[model samples]
Target: MIKIPGEKLIWMYKTMLKIRHFEDKIHRLFLEGNMPGTIHLYQGQEAVAAGVCANLERSDVITSTHRPHGHALAKGVAIKSLMAELFARSTGCCGGKGGSMHVGDPDVGMIPAIAIVGGGIPVATGIALAFKFQKSKRVAVSFFGDGACNEGSFHESLNMGAIWNLPVIYVCENNLYGASTSIRVAVKIRDLAERASSYGIPGVVVDGNEAISVYQATSKAVERARGGQGPTLIECKTYRRGGHSRSDACNYRDKEEEKMWLTRDPVVILRERLTKDGILTPEDSKQMEKEIEEELTQAIHFAENSPWPKPEEALEQVWA
Candidate 1:
């Protein structure tokens, strides 16, 4: 197992916690009719975002999917801005133009997440293309669900990255089901990573619930990309604790399948490893959670007190 730095481990812990609490608040707010629009919570898949982001520099770019709260938080977007956006407030990161699924902060190198399935793949490839063309060392990373692997853009983007040796990392968070359809039934290939072979780039599978494993996998891929070694496809085998969106009950899933994944909860796995390895104490973990909860409370208050976007302003940002 790769040894993560103490500071980096703590940062990853905080990032994951922020994601967890942010989404939890969103779930509550949506339930109470305080929020509009659908939400794709990133509750169970926090570690993948934290781990991959921990390996990236401020200059490196990341593209996110519909389920992007975790990625946005891990990429350094402000909690206040995120909550405001969720509430459709004018002070949001995108000035309320982008809502829950589109949360992002360009100052931190993240574009508004592409809510469309597999939409980020080509955009990330384009960002990498620009960096490659400019001879910049920055790498672009894309976060997409397993369903995205079957999309046409996935193949086209990977081929473009390989053919040009562009600096990109394609991450498939294989949470088994793509909005109710299981990967077993959706794709012919057993591993999503195997598809990278067709593009002549490296691909591998990792325990997405394990932050250390994900960090290590992403570090190497980032390094390879920075060296102009082209792209890598990483299939993170994980599970989503929540349903596809606010309305989904996940009735299509099996009880046994849900039970099995609940045992592999990423936060629990990380906390255990931290305690067992003498990196953190149980009290420390609890303290961290409380601190995060307090911050989230403040974020909600900030968002609630903020003003909603003005109706007339909508036409201002519209393009012909």
Candidate 2:
């Protein structure tokens, strides 16, 4: 385990808690028909988002995939705005336009999530190019699934980023399966980070369930990026506890595999580590959970009380 400040450790735990609780609430809302659209929950992969974003500056930007709530929250997006967006209320970050899959707040450095498998790759590369053009130290991160590794955009963007030495970090949250298709069946290589060598950039694989481990890997990658060394491909070996989407029952997954990953749940692992380290106590953990619940309640109330966007406003932000 890398040495981390007690405060940072606590923050990571809290962030993971928030993501878990938020996803749990969203799951219930979707099941009860309270939410407007389909959602790809981010239940088990909280550590990846918390650790990676913790190493970034406020000016640094990130592009997320369908599973973006964790990324949005980790990047400092307001909980109220996210809840409003999910509820399809006018006060949402996107004026209730972007539903579950498209949640983001650019003011907080997150681009509205692109639902396409590898869609955000090129966009993040472009953002990194802009940063280089402006001679800024800012970095752009693209968070994608292992399925995107096979996409042409992923290859092209990596090639461009490598050749131009753009300050970018490509984070592959390899959650064992990409929408029910196991990585074993999808790719030949065991480690996705190995693909980075083709672009002549550094490749790293880390235990994504361990927040400190992820933070360490991201810290090194960010330092290299800020120093103008070019891009890095970091493969985070993690797992998603829930189905790919709300409708999926994950019947394709083996029961033992699910049980094994559940045992390594990132939130539970981190909380245990914190408690064992004396950085957090049982009472403190309970208090944190209570506070997160209260915050979620407030956000839900704000979303429910807010009015829906007028029909006329639908095409206002659309650009053709």
Candidate 3:
């Protein structure tokens, strides 16, 4: 039983809807050959981003993994700017330099998402250190796949964050696969959160497909971090409704497994929960859906007409 403010509940549902529609549209754009480069979509795992971010402030920073569109949007990045980034338009958050996997906006409390596996772990830990040194109460969160847990950076980052009592939350989106490889075959332990005990920090497992559960877990961790209780490793057990990337067909996963997770779809779950409680009626659902559609339509239009960066400007953002 998770209790959230009525307005916050609706906001969470809307955020999940936005992520769903945004990723769906991105998949379409890629198929139509209108989008540049390959994409690692955050289709089914909307709950992780929306749930966690609902408890955060605009000033609280977060770091994202390759699948970052959801996190960017959840953290308050403008939809138009995000769509433009996917389109490689000059109006993008990274000025057309960061597309798809690199989607982020510092203005919205997200740095350009780290495309490398386990790369952002140490970066986020460092950001937490900086926050501590500056005496700022702000917290930093790092979102990574379960595969990142095996990386040395993950171990080092967790250890360092624990020892320093850094204000960071390590969110492991255990979608059960590190790309095409299954988590079952990779790690001996089914629950990755258990590894946090080695570092003496709180490790939690949450229903990542359920927005309320994820929100509650994150809210507690955020509160603890804000009170200087150190970092928490939250492992969210969820599934990626789509392939690992544009080139992946996800043929390796069992049909039954995908079907099971699909039934627990985050967006649908939230809507039903709200509707069941009479917080959201049939008409309210329709209105929310319509508004989201309109917003996404505007985002697409903005991306379509946006300008591209000049060829000469490529070297401008690069450092020698």
Candidate 4:
């Protein structure tokens, strides 16, 4: 087991709880018809975001996918702003425009998430190129799904990042299925990390269910990027607890496979580990949960009370 500071462990644990609870709240809201648009919940993959973002500095930016709430929260986006965005309120991070798939706050170092498949890969690479040009040590991380690995943009971006030694990391969260398609059906390679060899960059695979494992891998990749070595591709093998979208029943997934992954729930694993290691007391854990619930409740209230955007405000940010 990798040694992590107790404080950091607690932080990761809290973050995972926040992501889980936030998604649960959103799920309920969506079902209750209180939220507009749709959501891609990050219920089971909380460890990946918490672990990876813990290694990043406030200056290091991350590009997110359509499933962005976990990334946004881990990257320090305010819960209230994100909730407001889902509520389509004027006070949202995107002023009620970006909604669920586009949640982000650049002041906190996350670009508004790109909903298009594999779209953010090249964007993150470009940001890394800019970082290199300016001689900054900051890194850019692109979080994409397994489906995105096959996209032409993924290949081109990796090639460019490798050639220029860009300060970037390509994190592929392989949750087995992309939408309704299994990764086995889409890609021939058993290990997606193998794709990195073609570009001459280091490739790594980690247990996405283990926060310490992910943090350690990201730390190494970030160190390499800062040293001007090049980009690193880290594939996190995780599973999503929920369906792909709001309407999905997940009937396509096998019950046995779901049972297996459920046993390894990241949040529960970490909490137990911390308790057993004497790093977290039951009292402390309970307090943390209470605090998170209160925080989320306050965020919901803020979003519910926030005013909607004026009709003309929609035209303000349009460029084309």
In candidate 4, stretches whose alpha carbon ends up further than 4 angstroms from where it belongs are: none
lDDT measured at residue 145 in model 4 versus the true structure, 0 to 100: 97
Off by over 4 Å in 1: none
Regions of candidate 2 where Cα sits further than 4 Å from its true position: none
Q: Write the per-residue lDDT of candidate 2 for residues 105-201, one digit (tens) a residue.
A: 8888999999999999999999999999999999999999999999999999999999999999999999988897999999999899999999999
Cα-based lDDT at residue 283, candidate 2: 98
The digit string of per-residue lDDT tens for model 3 on 147-191 reads 999999999999999999999999999999998899999999979
Per-prediction tally of clashes: 0, 0, 0, 0
- Candidate 4 has its poorest 10 consecutive residues by lDDT at 1-10
Q: What tens digits encode model 4's per-residue C-alpha lDDT throughout 113-171?
A: 99999999999999999999999999999999999999999999999999999999999
Per-residue error (Å), model 3, residue 14: 0.2
Runs in model 3 deviating more than 4 A are: none
Considering TM-score, which of the candidate structures 3 and 4 is the better prediction for this target?
4
**Top of the candidates by lDDT:** 4
Model 1 error, position 311 (Å): 2.2
Model 2 clashing residue pairs (backbone): none
> Could you list the CA RMSD of all candidates, in the order they appear?
1.1, 1.0, 1.1, 1.0
Per-residue lDDT tens digits for candidate 1, residues 1-320, read 56678989888887887788878888999999989888898989999999999999888899999999999999999999999999999989888879999989889989899989999999999999999989999999999999998899999999999999999999999999999898889988889899989999999999999988899999989989999999999999999998988889899999998999999989888888888888889898889889989988998899889998888979876679
In model 1, the Cα lDDT at residue 261 comes to 93
